[model samples]
Target chain A: MFQNDAFRALDRQESLRLLAKVPVGRVVYTRQALPAVLPINFSLDTDASVLLRTSPDSDLVRAIDGVVVAFEADEFDAATRSGWSVVVTGRATVVTDPDEHERLSQADPTSWMPLRDPVFVRIESEMVTGRGLRGTRGTQ
Target chain B: MFQNDAFRALDRQESLRLLAKVPVGRVVYTRQALPAVLPINFSLDTDASVLLRTSPDSDLVRAIDGVVVAFEADEFDAATRSGWSVVVTGRATVVTDPDEHERLSQADPTSWMPLRDPVFVRIESEMVTGRGLRGTRGTQ
Candidate 1:
């Protein structure tokens, strides 16, 4: 019963599943009271939270801690014009527990940047929304 | 003079140039005081503003109008592990003037969803930042 003929809305479970398939997403946060976005490598945790590993000294670590942020990932084929996008929005907190850090460091979520004393930031899966575009009405 | 070895920073002009190369990007805005992102087709205006055409009643139109939002576009090669992402932060305003609307409607910026009485939103090119990742140190 989708009103829009061009796209289909995705449920939370499907959205998280699509998110896990992508290696990177754009994180949206407030920088100096203005919106800012950066693309970073991320992983969908077992609980559906977004896990990001970055350098401890990076500004991203400082900006997102204890704040609400948005993460979005999508894959679109210009030729087929069909793709899906998933957005996860929630509060982000830095994981400081020594044991958890050790586990994550050993597991090693893929990083575009090399890791040396990395900081793990978690974005709770509080609100998830996504859409699948299959080009034209009959394409699906 | 780069602090991060994983990515190279792109200047504003270069970032704007890259923004024009893509047909789509994600727009970040505040939905009920939390961050929200949506992927949509867009074009870069001659003045570097981000132009979007969507249905007049779309939630995105209401959420971003006259507000500070972030627009991001990127291209990546999964096989080569090389890509660039550009983010534009500025105020978004709906173009209400009939003449201006007529001009844009005639030009018809690319739209993923077919346009029926589309509304034009302009995001100013106030702050632009980008990063280029060449995989590893030796790859670049």
Candidate 2:
């Protein structure tokens, strides 16, 4: 299982497909000229864009408007020490259009915090890449 | 349960304790003037530095040597919609000292891929912060 060729690079389409399945991921953005990462629950739209539901007062909403950010998600089995990780890099835009906002709000991306002026943000995928382990052998 | 003050800030020591329990996290670093995040298996040393195991030729090894980076991890429960996330911003240094290298290598951080020319990197925790939801009511 720990073969020399066990590591595999996932293509763009495959990576996006995986992203659509995972419900939680981390969004990495620049804060005060330094990198910061926050775990978020996200959904994938039909056009492969990532959607996040945040609070209006959230720092992510304030800092990430019209900014490029890296969003990443993965599924790893600690017992097998095998998993896949997908990363999407894109510009985040807050959804203000009433119709789109309503539709996304109805789609109901999970938010742990209480709903008080929920903000919807969309990240259009500019680049997608992933890596996976081919086999499982070692216990994590 | 869904109160306005549900979010609570975690102090540096509390954040480090949570990080020590998690086996995997994403490391955010600057690459070509853009933020890049990658999943890595890590362990916390006595001094609160983040330690990672990777191949010598991996990009993380090449790019993050003596570079400032952010490492983040979280544990969220989908049913209760409660979780805490911790982020550590620090400088990553490749461990080349013979004694320290051997000691870390023996510690055995989980790696899914085959171990060949394994490289150990350390990120000394310069700043650590975390946030957690105090009560669980929403479903995420």
Q: Model 1: per-residue lDDT, tens digit, A8-102?
A: 88999999889988888889988888788888888877788999987677788889999989888999977777899998889999999999888
Fraction of true contacts retained by every candidate, in order, equals: 0.35, 0.54
Clashing pairs in 2: none
Model number with the top TM-score: 1
Please state the error at residue A118 of candidate 2 in Å.
1.6
Candidate 1: docking tier: acceptable
Q: Write the per-residue lDDT of candidate 2 for residues B48-108, one digit (tens) a residue.
A: 8898887777777888998889999988877667779999998999999999998887776
lDDT of 1 by residue, B1-140 (tens): 13277678899999988888888898988888887888888887778888898777888888899998999999877666689999888999999999988877767555667656778899998989999987663211
Model 2 stretches with alpha carbons more than 4 Å out: A1-4, A138-140, B1-4
Q: Which residue pairs come into collision in candidate 1?
A: none
Find the 10 residues in a row with the least total lDDT in model 2 chain A: A131-140
Best candidate according to DockQ: 2
